[model samples]
Target: MLHSLDADLAVIDPEYQLRRAARVDNELIYLTRTGGGGARFARRIRRAREEVRTVCGVCGRPGIPRTRSRTVLCDLHWHPLTAVEKAFALSADIPEAWFTDEAEIKNDAYVARSAADQRKESANHLSERDMADLLGVTVQRVHEMFEQELLAGANHDGRVVYPRWQVMEGGRLLPHLPVVLRAADGIEARTLQAIMENVDEDLEGATPAQWLAHGGCVEPVLQTLDQWWWI
Candidate 1:
């Protein structure tokens, strides 16, 4: 997605002032650059300025970063003296309260990483010309299909590409794709694609795509999405 990554999208985190707003990956990190200079502490806790990026502002780790402050963290230090993160935290001189037994951060990281992996798998996709030829439709009709949510297409760079799974044998559209597409309305393309590919208990252990591919009922999939993805 083309994000402005502006001040409006940032958050003033309690532990780390100025955080990059959660985007497609649902990951947040400190915004290191700032304009004003004041009391060291005031400058310390403000939300990240608009210059933040995907890498950690400190050690350049993923979401987690290494810094003198107890600001950025990874799952490793959820519990003090527990994992390598704890050791790193201790060395960084962060407060013990910064550590917790809750594994929420780890879980979120896993989820984001899994979604990213799914995106990579779907990256080798069909272009507009490919879709038009396969469906025996004009390229203009293909654009209409995307606008109507009749097809699943994600924006990579500045262009939109349709994932291969959206088409079945002989270039036919995947089963129930139109239904799922409508149900998934308003969600960004990459996330919608990930939800379709991710496994869910409500789908009887099948991913949405797989369940549909097997001729599963569209209602159950929609219901599952109500409680999960679509919600």
Candidate 2:
């Protein structure tokens, strides 16, 4: 059994508690994230949009639309922002073009992939609870890794699942996964797997995962990702 302090940690972790609550009450999750209630949420959103239009959400640097970013984030703050809101949060001045969440990612010069077959890729999968155990980390860390896209996973049925291949001996993630995962933020796991496994022209021969496994630099992969248009 965990020590008393360890036992108390899960209840205290907002992500763990939120996960538990989400299993029971999705509406509660939505309400909590939106800051509660319909009218108040709308007001909060309106106020947020207004603030972002004038200043950089990251630094408060002031600039106008198009003069800064075609989107809400200013040019300096605009390096490879993903739709993962926690990873990149800004309420206002988000590009009208980029609205509907990373649709603009498609419209931008970025990586592109072909249609992925959505078969159930659930073999050797680990649950959130199981992965935490495997990594010997706190549940919160597991959530952070997944949310930050340092871990690759996909939704299977209604639940999220991570493939066993990403975890190596001693529970370490594959080399350079964090950097690669950052580029693949919105990609489906199968598509990402395909991209990583295939021998590509970019590397001049080796697959991306193989490239990294053999100690290749990550810059070339990032360049491909920079202009990646998601399929």
Candidate closest to the true structure, highest TM-score: 1
Worst 10 residues of 1 by lDDT: 12-21
- Superposed by TM-score, candidate 2 places the C-alpha of residue 74 at a distance from the truth, in angstroms, of 49
> What TM value does model 2 have?
0.42
User: What CA RMSD would candidate 2 show?
Assistant: 20.5
- What total of clashing residue pairs does each candidate reach? 8, 11
lDDT of 2 by residue, 206-227 (tens): 7766677667898887765554
Q: In order, what lDDT does every prediction score?
A: 0.57, 0.52
Output the number of the lDDT-best candidate. 1
Off by over 4 Å in 2: 1-120, 227-229
